[model samples]
Target: MTVTVDEKRCIACGMCAYAAPEVFRIVGSASTVVAQPEGKSPRVRDAANGCPVNAIRVEG
Candidate 1:
């Protein structure tokens, strides 16, 4: 449920926050990981996949 967004690649698109509000948020110019995604939830993967810049990464 670990979610991380690369600062260098994030574009603040807000899709991560929109798709996985529990785990992600847009802060200023970057997408920030707010909390870990729930176990086996599709939201996190969806958010990661939705990132046009491929900035979001999920582990475990």
Candidate 2:
């Protein structure tokens, strides 16, 4: 799966990192993709859904 974070919309809430630490991390004032999993990950989806600003995007 491919995971991406919209830094412009990110608020550094850390929800993505909390939901999928393996795929995301808080960097500076936004969330960044730390790892791209090989396939669709439930945690990634959760992270996307949990993002208050909807900055996380997951695609397969």
The most accurate candidate by lDDT is 1
Cα lDDT tens digits for candidate 2, 1-60: 788888999999987888878888899999999889767788789889888988887877
Tens digit of per-residue lDDT, candidate 1, span 1-60:
687899999999898899988888888899888777668778889988889999988888
Q: What is the lDDT of residue 28 in candidate 1?
A: 88
All predictions: root-mean-square deviation over Cα?
A: 0.9, 0.8
Residue 30 error, candidate 1, Å:
0.2
Superposed Cα RMSD, model 1: 0.9
Any idea how many clashes model 2 has? 0
